[model samples]
Target: MKKEASAKTWNTLRNITLVIILFIFIRYLFDEDPFNDRIGWSVLILFWTFKGLFDAVEDKRSGNKKSMVANIVFVIAGLGILLWQGIQFFLYK
Candidate 1:
C-alpha cells in the first residue's frame, strides 16, 4: 500500500477501537437496564454509520478511491447490524 493509504488505514483502525471502548464503557455504566441497553446499542450503531458516511463523503471529494470504498463498506455493515439489532430490540420491547 502507499504511505498515505497505510496512514489512513491506521487512523481508521484507531478510531474504531476507541469507539468500541467507549461503547463498552457506556454499556457497563448502564448494565442490565433494558431501555438504556437499547439506547446504548442505537447510539453506537448510529455513530459508526454516520462516521462512515462523513468519511466517505470527504474521501470522495478528495478523490481517494480506496478509502472511499472502505468507508462505504463500513456504512453498509453498520446499517446491516443496525437493522438486525433494531428488530430484536423492538420484539423484546
Candidate 2:
C-alpha cells in the first residue's frame, strides 16, 4: 500500500536524522569544552528525545509494534543518559 510505504520512508528518515544528531553530539562532546558546549548538548538531547517520541507515535499509528517498542526504549535510554550526565555535572563538578 502507498500509505504503508510512505510510513516506512518517514520512519527511515527519522532514524537517519536521529543517527546524524547523535553522531554530531558525540563528536562535540569529545572536541569541545563541556562548560561551553552544555547548551548545544542540551538542545541536541532535547531534539533527540522529542524525535524519538514522534517516531514512536508514528510507529504506533502505522501499527508497527516492534518499532514502537524500540522507539520507546531509545527514548528512555536517551533520557536516562541525559539525567545521569546532568547530575554528574551539577553535583560532582
Q: Among these predicted structures, which one has the highest TM-score?
A: 1
Q: Can you write out model 1's per-residue Cα lDDT over 1-93, one digit (the tens) per residue?
A: 697897798679768875875777487548877667666767677777877887897799789999999999999999989898889878986
Cα deviation in Å at residue 3, candidate 2? 14
Full-model lDDT, candidate 2:
0.80
**What are the per-residue Cα lDDT tens digits for candidate 2 across 1-93?**
998898789878887877777777666767657664774576587677879898789888879999999999999988997888789889977
- Per-candidate TM equals 0.62, 0.59
Error of 2 at 24 (Å): 14
- Scored by CA lDDT, what does every candidate get? 0.80, 0.80
TM-score of 1: 0.62
Clashing pairs in 1: none
